[model samples]
Target: MVFLIQKSQNKDSKAIHLKLSEIIASHQGTSNRMVNIEDLTELELDQLRKFYVQLSKLAAKEDA
Candidate 1:
């Protein structure tokens, strides 16, 4: 999954995946974890989507 995501042309997706990788890598136990995408609030999800859209535009410009 990480390999596929890291290959993404969209910088936001790549960056988000990297951050997720770091969070998983730093985990110490099976029961305890800090990164929880499922627990994100609606506002946070909206913000994340906005960021992705912004980055996607930048990616398109770069491609052009």
Candidate 2:
């Protein structure tokens, strides 16, 4: 039962990832680098998270 549930969840996750990849590819300003973001290492994801946080701060400052 547990294995079946896990498999279903994995399938759903893959579908979601594919949909997001398609959206990223079709969007003009979106970064193609983000298409396979799930494959990034933990450290790389952390670095990207930090970069986005800083970007958010900068945007906030601009709005103020």
RMSD of each: 12.1, 6.1
Q: Model 2, range 1-35, lDDT digits (tens) per residue?
A: 99988866765565455445445445366556666
Alpha-carbon deviation at 43 in model 2, angstroms? 0.4
lDDT of each: 0.53, 0.61
TM-score of model 2 vs. true structure: 0.56
Give the lowest summed-lDDT range of ten residues in model 2.
Answer: 18-27
Writing each residue's lDDT as its tens digit, candidate 1 over 1-57 gives 887665443544544554454444444733233245435554565565576567668
The regions of model 1 sitting more than 4 angstroms off are 1-35
Best by TM-score: 2
Q: What's the TM-score of every candidate structure?
A: 0.46, 0.56
Q: Which candidate is the best by lDDT?
A: 2
Q: Per-residue error at 52 for model 1, in Å?
A: 0.4
> Residue 25 of model 1: what lDDT?
43
